[model samples]
Target: MKGILKKVYVIFFISYFVFFTSWFPGLSFFNNSNKVELNDNVKLQAQAPDYWPTTGWRASSPESQGVSPQKLQEMEDYIVSENIGGYIDSLLIVRNGYLVYESYPSHIYDANIRHHIFSCTKVFTSTLIGVALEEGYISGLDDYVLDYFPNRTFDNMDYRKEAITIKDLLTMTSGIAWTDQVDYYQMAFSYNWVQYVLDQPMVHQPGEVWNYNTGGSHLLSAILDRETPNGTLDYAKTRIFDPLNITEYSWNLDRQGIPIGGTLLHLTPRDMAKFGFLYLNNGTWNGTQLIPASWVAEATTSFIDVEFDQSHGSGYGYQWWIYNWLNAYTARGSNQQYIVVIPDLNLVVVSTGNTEYQFIRLLVDFILPSAGFTPLNLVFVISLIVGTISLSILLGFTFFHFKKKRTIKKLRKEFFEETDSNGETFQ
Candidate 1:
């Protein structure tokens, strides 16, 4: 009876283990300290905004915007506990065109302060190119590179260099023979920045390879300067900034007085989100189309499949990183600056962190799930409930079986003792 009960107990535990593991495939409840508890069947109903955030954004509670406040709190706590609090400049989440969550973790930055958004400036540069195309300042994406700089003669002149197009530059597949780490520093110190970029020898045919070249981005800025009235900075001030009411911002210029297109644009976190919101609403701000709808769609679409070995992206669009899993896109920069837009969720997340942390992990593991995007699996829930009930029944059966056996053994021992005593008395 003891051996049978022992075997039954082992079988019960094995079944329980199998059921538990099957219920949560990827997540181990005992292993991960920060395991996500499912908020089952959460349907996000976006609340329409009362007004456009052209002048300033309206504030709303996370729950009101169909965002989980508990998840946001967990994200904040993770930042603090990870010792990333000091380096984090700002973190803001915009859902349904309202500012749902905002945190200045570093305590040094705020809504009023402008933060330097490094390579995120590239996305803005790409946007201006779209604007210029719409306004007829430039001809089209297929226009050759050499045609733009007709006055200047370039070195290593080949058919490949002549074949480079604006679209090639926009997608970072210019095929220019340049190492970003070495060449970018050299280009920065050179006398004529645009001339230096244009003069680089063609390594591969344009649009055949994807290489990160900040110099190529600067070439874009120079092109804008030539095509647009007054220059890139002035053109942006009139066309983008003033219209969006984005006042109090700065742009750093190159040696040739063209705005450094790859980096060095500063704006407040709120203002950074406005650019994201503009893209989210398909380039429309308020009732007016700030950027052409077609341009926004084309810019965010992945043109090249590149690998950065990061959670944020493995695909590249026109100056945008595509997160295919989330069906989102981001204007990502070094040191963890990002303007992530999830169209499906009607969400925009902006962060300017001086220190590098896995912001994508936060987005995927916490934020997206918190937005109630991942619904609980019905099969798993049903199995969990059934397994718990079965285990309870098995435990109760085992307990009663042992109790009944003990009772029978005690009665038999008492009967034998009485029989022995009566037999001895008769003798």
Candidate 2:
């Protein structure tokens, strides 16, 4: 009886560890996306023109942009309706260099707002690493993780700990035992977050297996801060945010004043779209290569097997969640904050809401089918706007002519009536 009870206890313990270590990834529980295929209508189209959004995004009708305008309206109706599982704060869609569709609740969130992005911040951290590598701030991804932190003391440092590389952290293969109980959640509250992260005992050899380690990500930020001239946040401000036109944003810092890269960033949905757009353009923004195209390719390419949702190439990028929809990859956060990029479709979809993972259904079920195959060119939009204005003017002139004729006819009738129903003029 004692032996049986001990075995059962061990099984229960292992089960709890498995369940608790991997935090809620905020995807639908019923996702069976690996076998799903792209809808025929959402097929890949020709390349979209390279248009820079310097000042602001240009607006156009969805239909004009090869996205069904009626479908967007219906999607908006659904967004506004109560059937939406949770509070959907905002949904902004950009396709072929135009802001074809956007929805927001004005009362809950301001028109220009930023909120907690949670784990999506990890992708931004990954971008900073790319910039660091491109600018020679970071030598390479294979460099030893501990080499950057010479001043810091790590407890129980071993051969595996020394073998951990920047890439290992980027890919979450550091083998650091960062589960729910012995993880970043507890480390965040500790007096020294960075030190606490460095002190974590290695559970597996470096580069052996992939496991989500928030502490390992924080170490990346710390390394960026150490290597960069202005520190991680400042480096990001000049390197990523300034170039991308992301003016309004804030990143949480630890007690050591180091930018917490693992989580706690507040960014607007549009700004999130800009980051996605930056990646979709392959590290280039307006022809200037902010991040090396090489790094972008490496970062976006599947480093390990991860099935986040139902679509092809559902693997983990540097920090991005590779989803199955339209072959999209995204910077996703808790509570449905996502900046999904569909390269083949030339689409960037940004959303922030309280509903967990239901937005995927919203996007795949409603948005894709409703979109058109062809790109919506800027020349067409300008011509359409001009045409609309010209048509409105013509209608205005026609209405004026009819109004003038009607007034004259009424006056003549009144005059004839006053003059005893014969030809006569009234005053």
TM for every model, in the order presented, reads: 0.77, 0.73
Candidate lDDT values, in order? 0.82, 0.75
Per-residue lDDT of candidate 2, residues 201-236 (tens digit): 889998878898888889899999989998999998
User: Clashing residue pairs, candidate 2?
Assistant: 33-310, 66-372, 311-324
Tell me the number of clashing residue pairs for each predicted model: 0, 3
Q: TM-score of predicted model 1?
A: 0.77
RMSD (Cα, Å) for all candidates, in order, is 11.4, 26.3
Per-residue lDDT of candidate 1, residues 186-259 (tens digit): 98899998888888998898998999988888878889999998999998898788888999799999877899
